[model samples]
Target: MKPDYELLVRGNNLRLKDDFLGMSNVTLIQGPSGPILFDTGGYISRLGLLKALDARGLKPADIPLVFLSHLHFDHAHNVDLFAHAEFLVSRREWDYVGAPHPDDLLVPWGIREQLSKSRVTLIEGEGQIDRGIGFFPAPGHTPGCFAIELDTERGTTVIAGDAIKYAKEAILRRCDMAFDEIEVGTATIRNILDRADRIMPGHFPELVRLPDGNFVWDEAAPFELMVR
Candidate 1:
């Protein structure tokens, strides 16, 4: 049977001068084995993340697995919430974070120490995370970034984290914040676009690829923000 997915917290790409409001997507996947929490949102979305799980009749402790796309602060900061789940992060990422490039401010200073306290399974190369869910290296945005490929009733779906940050990156085949060579990042984007029937981008609404090789938002309206 195919797996089912839901975007627990929609990612937002907002900027204010030199600051970026990093609200990365948090997703829940009901795979054949059990429910998997993909990419725990950061401190900014902590409360909402808890509420989202509660709405689905789940608590952080109820999650059995947590798949981190990478260790960027916006995406991995909330791992502590799921104290009982086994985290799956890339081995390359684990090693790279030890001495990440000085300019890669996204890698929180003490994240490695935090992760060491948890039960983490360092993934290597392409492999299956669970029934119907396969993962492969999708480097460039980060040296060890990985993306999920799942078989759904519709077809093949890719949960492309920062490897394909948004629709623009997929469409234009470029990255705005690449840690690797720009060509490598663009190449990764091209591969994902070619392979996925639908893409869950890191900071954009889900996209459905058309037969004519174009993509459109998947029935959901763009994210909205409200200020009082």
Candidate 2:
């Protein structure tokens, strides 16, 4: 059976002067074993994340597995919330984080110390996590960045965390932000566009593949903000 899924937190690419929004999308997939969460949001979305979970009638402990696409602060910092869940991270990611370049500011400091307290499992290469859910390498933004593939009623959806952060990237078939070689990131984007019927990007609304072989954003609820 195809497991159910939901977008717990819709990611955004908004940034302000001297301030980065750095909000990545968080997805919840109901696996055969139990609830599996893909990429927990950063500290900025802490309360919003909790409220999102509560709205779904779930607690952090209720999640059995947490998958990190990479070790970016916007995507991986909130892993601490799920104390009881087993975290699935890329083995390559773990190694890279251990000796990240000083200029990579998106990688939070003290990651090893933070995750040492949790039960973490390292993943390598492509593999299936469940019957309809699997993972494949899509590194670019980070050396170990991986994207999750889900077989849903809508067809194959790729949860491309930062690998294909925006629809424009997929549409352009290139990555705008790449810590690695730009060609490597572009290749990853092309690979994703070639295989995925739809894409749940890291920091943008979902993208649907058109019959004409073009990718366009799906209709999503409007983002709201309150001003005093």
Candidate 3:
């Protein structure tokens, strides 16, 4: 089965807000087994996100699995929207949420009940959630920050989450730019770059590798994810 997918680039050009510091992206993966919703976009874009999904002939109820990159409000606000989908979160991530630090202000509190009230799987480290979907710890933006990987038609593509917020930052190997852990962030970026053919970052433009082992931003690329 090929990993077929589309990105609702809400964090990028979807909204026009000069003051918005960063953008959030939500992905819809039409897996062989079922539909997978990756990240729920932002709270402010709830209605827009729903419309976007409707435009694609999909609904939150139709999604069977909801995988979150992290629990940041911008990327996780709409999680509760998928009333029946099973939510997958990092075990370590919830630990921080259970006891948030001052710096970890992005902790999602509104959907606290939804997070655990439904069927939730606490992913610890790297493991396969489905046939072609996998995840591993890549903390930086948050304590239990993680990223999701997919076996797509393009190759091994990874949704790098906030681990490498921007493709430019990945090229620089800069971890100091993250919100939480710094050193681990840089290492995680390197780790993803070394393996993934393409990376859909959390904030910046998606990055595809060139023949020269360099990455360039692709603003027009449509991620047709297919999982085999």
Candidate 4:
């Protein structure tokens, strides 16, 4: 069966007035087996996700799997909330997240502890997670960052977690401020644009499609202003 998915915009672009530097969107994918979530948003976002699920008549326990695009605080800070779900992440990303870093304290250690007990699935290559949902390594934004390609009834939707934060950024080849490696990030952005028919960025408003075989912004505006 084809998976049903919904992109939940968890955080805002302007995180704190002057910081136009975060892309924190959580994707909820309901498959034949069970529900799966992509990215957990920031620490404060856990309650918001629970409340949103509650309003929709769903519960956190309903989610059996959770995938992280990367280990950045803005993307996976609330991972500890899904205690019952199996966590999926790229092997490279897992190594990066698990590596000894002085800044690790910034993220809740509880989350890491929970992860240790939870069933963690480390993806190593491009493959299908389900009939129509697939994952492929798109390193650069982070060593282990991966992108998802979902073949939906509407079209093929690519959930680009920070590989291409904004549609315009993908078009112009602009890298995010927090990228660990700029060259790798740019290459990943290009790879995404090459394969995606519809692009749903991490913190952007909604999906944008290349309807006429050309990059189109969500508001039908020019790429520059749309990203700005």
Best first by lDDT, ranked? 1, 2, 3, 4
Task: Quote model 4's TM-score.
Answer: 0.83
Model 3, 1-228: lDDT tens digits are 887677765455333374454557777877878888888877766887888888988777888898888787888887778767788889887777777668666767755676776788888978987788888988876777888889999898988777877666678877655566678787888898888889888776778899988889857633332599
TM-score to native of every candidate shown: 0.96, 0.95, 0.88, 0.83
Given candidate 1, what's the lDDT at residue 156?
Answer: 94
Model 4, span 42-149: residue lDDT tens? 865667788877887878787888888877778887766777888888888777766634533433444556677778888998987777889988776667888888
lDDT of 3: 0.77
Taken over the whole model, the C-alpha lDDT of each candidate is 0.87, 0.87, 0.77, 0.72
Model 3 residue 13 lDDT? 30
Candidate 1 RMSD to the correct structure? 1.4
Task: Compute the lDDT for candidate 1.
Answer: 0.87
lDDT of 4: 0.72
Worst 10 residues of 3 by lDDT: 13-22
lDDT of 1 by residue, 135-206 (tens): 998988988899999999978999998898887887777877787667788888989989999999888889
TM-score of 2: 0.95
Per-residue error (Å), model 1, residue 210:
0.6
